[model samples]
Target: MPKSVWFLIIGMLVNTTGNSFLWPLNAIYMHDYLGKTLAMAGFVLMLNSAAGVLGNLLGGFLFDKIGGYKAIMLGIFLTVVSLIGLTQWHEWPHYVWLLTLLGFSGGIVFPSMFALAGTAWPEGGRKAFNAIYLAQNVGVAVGPALAGIVAEKGFDNVFEVNLWMYVLFFFIALLTFKRFETDSVVPKNVVSERKRITNKASLYALLIISSSSVLCWIAYSQWSATISSYTQDLGLSLKQYSLLWTINGLLIVAAQPLIAPLVKRWENNLKRQLVFGVVIIAISFGIVAFASDFKMFAAAMVVLTFGEMFYTPALPTIANQLAPKGRQGFYQGILNSATTVGRMIGPLFGGIMVDQFGMMALMSILVIIVVIAVIPCLVYDRPLVKRSKSTTVLE
Candidate 1:
């Protein structure tokens, strides 16, 4: 791997660690600490996700126009500002405002980062994204475990730690990522990339692929939303719930080596790979519906991680393939925006189901949602009929 990618990986690890400290705990803090109902907490989170959607779109556009260095730094600066505010004021209205700001800032950073990674290493293909994904999970593993320990003292410590990690991440990117952005020497596969499709067809393909992405996140976000409450209601402590994510992170890191051969076999057929992942996630949610113990919830998380290992990296890879000469960042932004839409609606949806119908109903619907994602994955590429050159079609 290139040193630039390594820096990006390192930056991503730190960035995600900071994010993990708050995200996994957000709903819990809203409900338990701040005296809000689950529905209200979900509504606030919905607003946060809405901001993230806008940020994702704007960030991708900025990356294409201004270059990744400036765009990413802008995002980091804003994110740092949000964290500073969060560290000082964490009461109800203040927390909600800062968290939403964090979402927007964080959203701006991600597509730029992913686009840079893909740009830095187009030849590396899935390898580049896989590494970034691994870094994120490693942060996920480490962040929440440390957060659990810190929260044993107080939630205020969690905010401070999160702020410091983002600060470290900001400095790391400031120092290293600029060189990477200026030094993008790898040639793009322009002829092959533009051979078979129109920009409109490609954009439609992305939207189709993103539909599955959205659905998968709806099911996946439950682990952070209703499932957290469900586990606590069943007598698990905060530490134990945090440990579940630690296990998820560690499992994703360790299981990659074992899952590689299967991924390699499905390398040419991303749709097949995605189908396998979605099915496994559906099965995992099925397990969650019946789970009553920490071990069972842990088992569900393990299964969930396995599914995403196949599912997550492919979305960005597909976007890279579909992107035209100058739209890689924009395409990546669309993919991220889809996932944000899922995350945005998921909590409120889950909260409603749990509040009215109960836990079993919530779990059942999650499994169905996961299963439904496969349809889009299968059909997203159908409209592309090979042509001599890239054409801009009105359709």
Candidate 2:
């Protein structure tokens, strides 16, 4: 990998580390410490995710128009400011407002980071995305372990730790990415009409793929929202809950070496890989429905982590492949938006279901939704597959 790519990875590590401290605790803190109901906690999270959707779109546009450096810095600045305010005033409405702003700011950073990674190592293929994904898990691994300890002291300590991480992240970005430049303006007439049509077809496929991704995230996000609260209701400690995430992150990092070969083997069959992974994810949730102890929850998490490892890296790689020249950021932004949309809806939906119908009902419904998502995943690339077959015949 290039120096620039490594820098991006390091930046992601710090950035995600800061973020992981807060997000995994958001639902629990709101419900337990702040005296909010699970349903209300979910609503706050939904608002946060909605803000993220806007930020994803805006960041992508700015990355295309201004460049990654400026766009990322802008995001970091906003996020840091929000974090500072959160440290001081984390009461009810104030906490909600700061968290929403944090979501927007953080959202801007993610799409830009992914876009920069794609540009940094265009020839690196899945390796580029895998690196970023790995860095994220590394953050997850470190952040939650430390957060678990800090939360033992107080939730205020958790917020302070997160604030410092972002401050470090901002400095890293300032020093390392100041000269970063990847944006390019493609000439309108450079491509013939036929190639333009091809680009459009590719984009359509990407959108379909993105839709499937959204559904997958909706099911997956229950871990942080309803499932987190559900565990506490089952008499699990906060330390145990945090430990689950630590286990998830450690498993991803530890298993990546073994998983990479399989990923390469199926590199040409991303759709098949997605379907297989989604099945595992759906099954994991079914297992969760039966879980009555921390051990069973941990078992479900291990399965869910495997599924995530398989599919998560592929999403960005596919987006990078489908992106037209000068629009990598925009396409990545769309992909981020899809994931954010799922996240935005997931908490609220899960909260409502659990509140009204109960945990078993929510789990059953999620499994069904995930299974249905496989349809779009399987069919989204029909156009591209057809084009490939036709080209092969012509040859």
Candidate 3:
């Protein structure tokens, strides 16, 4: 493996290990352990998600202006501080502020990571990125599975582990910073012709698709937010819930590497894959609404994982394909922002509908949103190709 790839993997592992507990249990801790209501928990997540969206946008701007390693190191430090706060503190107002900080800081890490990967191998950024993607899924799979096992001992145990995870990430990041500085890898201006294309029409169409795609993720994100509670209401244990997360992670690991060749085969036409992802996610969540048995829920998750496999890799691929030269980081940041949008709004949307009308109603609404998101793929088909020797940006 290349040194750069190792850097990405180690960074991802540390980041995700902290994220494992933070994401799955954050809301649960607020609502169940800390005595906040479900709506209140959703609201806190909403605030965090909103912060994340802004962070993605600003992080992109920072990456574009300042550079990669500096921005990412700052993000890692902030995240570490946030984790420490969450582990030690328990008050409502303080936790809310910490959650906001965590979301904001965590937001910076992703776009910077993607931008750095894109810059490091200007020629094969996407393929090299596939490795980073795989590493992330591995971390995702491990974090929740481990969290589940520890949560069986108690929620505090989970939080304690997360604190250590952040400490691990902090030191690893320090090492990563030194490694990047000493390494030969640096951003190269390989693209001789610099073009700047800002198609408002296309950008609008993309955001519409992005919003809808985000809604599907919102639907998927519910499995962690409310679905676990729903399963517990149905009498499942933490171990069983962990099994579900384990299945989701394994699917991502097994599926992501396979996605690279297919994406390559599809080349710049990754929008079609994005459409397929939305469709699959919609179907899975729709089924989950009716699931009464463990097997049925497992089947729904399998379908959901298929959608994830298609969508997660394709989002960045499409962004890169559409992005102007020298601005891939900005658009990738935008792509990260879309996920934050979905996460921020998803909890509120899912919580309300599920609280009022139940899971079926929530799933129905997500299906419509996803269908609406797919419409743009029909008309927005041009790949932002580099104009060999020209320096002008065009449609």
Alpha-carbon RMSD of each model: 3.2, 2.2, 4.0
Model 3 lDDT on a 0 to 1 scale: 0.72
Instruction: By TM-score, rank the candidates, best first.
Output: 2, 1, 3
Candidate 3 lDDT over 263-356, as tens digits, reads 6667666677777777887788778878887888889988988887877776666666555555665777888898898888877777777778
Q: Write the per-residue lDDT of candidate 1 for residues 1-395, one digit (tens) a residue.
A: 99889999999999999899989888888888998878888888888898999999988988888888888899999999998898899997999899899889988999999999999988999999999999999999999999988887999999999989988998998899989784332245555444434777788889999999999988888888888878878999999999999998899999988999999999999889899988999999999999999999998999889999999998899999998767888999999999999999999999999999998998888888888899998999866653323344412
Let me know the TM-score candidate 2 reaches against the reference structure: 0.95
Candidate 1 Cα lDDT to native: 0.88
Per-model TM values vs. the true structure: 0.94, 0.95, 0.87
- Return the clash pairs for model 2, or none: none
By lDDT, the best candidate is: 2
- Please give the lDDT score at residue 340 for candidate 1: 95
